[model samples]
Target: MTDWKKIRAEFPALENWIFLNTATFGQLPKRATEAVACHFARRDRYACSDFMGWFEDADSVRATIARLIHAAADDIAFIPNACTGLSLMMGGMDWKPGDRIVTLEDEFPNHYYYPGYLAAQGVEFIETPFERFYDAINQRTRLVALSMVNYSTGFRPPLEEISGFLRERGVMLYLDGTQGLGALQLDISAIRPAMLSVDGYKWLLAPTGGGFIYVDSELRRHLRPNIIGWRSHRDWRNHENLHHGTPEFGTEAEKYEGGMLSFGPIYGMAASVEMMLEIGPEVIDERVMQLAGSVRDILRRAGGVLRADSDSLYISPVVTARFEEKDAGVLAHELKSRKVLVAARHGNLRVSPHFYNDETDLERFEAALKQVL
Candidate 1:
């Protein structure tokens, strides 16, 4: 049994604001902040004395991330952000002339930008409505890329069914898991996407610049490294022997990492990942869903318009409610003035609660909504 009170103590920011914006960015725990501080302190003490130790910490962070996603440690690579991962996957692919890439409408810019970058190489970009993504896959389609949860509407798609359908047709599937990483429970092995990327700052409670890319072992062989660096090689210490030509590419997905990795963010991320491991994702998922469900029930009783279907089980932990007469932007600002933080996206208020939030936070938000509406 996970104690909400104990979990709340880990995050000091919760004491200040009723944070319902985990979908935008999570509040970092005190321990994670302290870890980064300690790392910087060590750097000041002896600048280059512990150079090897820093790399070891980075490797440990990679292993922890791998465990969280149920992927082999070698199959995960740390990237600066979700966009970097998307670029690596999209640019590395061998797209033939007229090869089609399918994505959803209102998709994140990177989804279009990366594919658009490939368009310069003669690849075709196809944008389809969310309801028709399944039917959009055809023989010319080489890859199907989309978000697991829509950031605007918080709609969680049927990943299992979509992946299965694509796999049968020999099409590659890629997912941007930013909106549903810590808030939802997922088994990467079950969905088996060709590649998946997540930004830890949003839902994983880590600092910015922390994110990873997961490349399926089978798919790794087909991907060429777009951005290469010394660290991407197996033996980065042998930099003096660069005359021997680019070090043999790593057999695993680590080959995708480019240049020097940031140690400060890795230190902070390690702390956050440790806390998640201690509490367990299953418990976190249950608590977050319960809190979100409670908010949904209250909104329904208030007769607000819900963008997502009521029967949808895969709804993102984030919930958005539309107002009939009142402006959502005005209501969002009103909620913020009352110390409740919610985001206004696509004319709806996006309320995302983490495990640390309890019934009190929910009631406070509801009360604020009533006053504003």
Candidate 2:
């Protein structure tokens, strides 16, 4: 068994505050911050003297992300964030006028933003509840975009069932793993989605402005490289001399990275992911669910909470509770003032505890929540 108390010590930010808000942002591990600071420290001592080292770090991190998701390193593209990664894939697809896009009702805005633009080009954008999401997929449906775990209600969709169904129908499945990636186990072999994007900040315990996308080889014909630059080409080597001309971009997912990368964040992300791999993904998942489940029970026993409604079938680490008499934003502020941080989303209170959180954090939250209620 893993010593979760030692794991919890990795996050110094947890020392002073009760942080159960991994859904909005995760507390960066001390090693990640140190790695980032070390990179800049080297820069301070010497200019771009170690340019090759940056490329090496980026490539190694790519391989690390591949191991995390069970994909080929070449198939992974480092992205600025999940939204940018999704936009890159969406831009590449050969969308026709009548092509239809189906997504969930309350997804992070990326789902609606990209499809909203496609709507002007005569593409049908259908937003429905998870219950009717399957029925919405007709012959005209080109893609099914959704979150692996819902951000608002903490509902996890049946990816195995949905992926197999879409595979039989030859439809594409675009998944956003921001809320699920590091907390849950996601094997590409099981889902086989056409494309998946994730943010490294939340759950992954990395800094902002870093993420990745996994593009399937089967979608090569449909989704061409819509964005490119010097680093995007297959022969983008430019250590001694710059090579430029009519560049040839490969069908690998890296073709969408239009420019240079932020190496500091790259190193930070590598450190964070390495920490997670050491702890074991399954171990982390089990711990997170255990804490969130305990949180739900506490909320239940406390009383004074209303049922906006909940689906207990497929649940993730995100635990949400509704209080009809209390405003969620006010409650969140009150909790934060008491040094207990949580999030209010779409009129519901969303609390997400990670592997670093301990039972003490839960007890404090339980006390704070009761006092606020």
User: What is each predicted model's overall lDDT from 0 to 1?
Assistant: 0.85, 0.84
Q: What C-alpha lDDT does candidate 2 achieve relative to the native structure?
A: 0.84
Candidate 1 error regions (>4 Å): 239-244, 310-314
Best by lDDT: 1
lDDT of 2 by residue, 65-167 (tens): 8898888887788776888877777888778888999998888788999999988789999999878988999999989898988888787888999999998
Q: Model 1 reaches what TM-score against the true structure?
A: 0.96
Error of 2 at 184 (Å): 0.8
Clashes of 1: 0
Instruction: Give candidate 2's error at residue 150 in angstroms.
Output: 1.1
> Which residue segments of model 2 deviate by more than 4 Å?
304-310
- Please give, for residues 1-373, the per-residue lDDT of candidate 1 as tens digits: 6678988988888898998889889999999999999999999999868877887787788888888878788878887789888888888888898899999887778889878888778999999986788788889999988887778778787889989999999999999998888878778998999999988898888899988889998888889898987766777756566434565777878788867777778889889988888899888999999998898877777778886565473366879888889887898899889999989887877888888899999998888888988
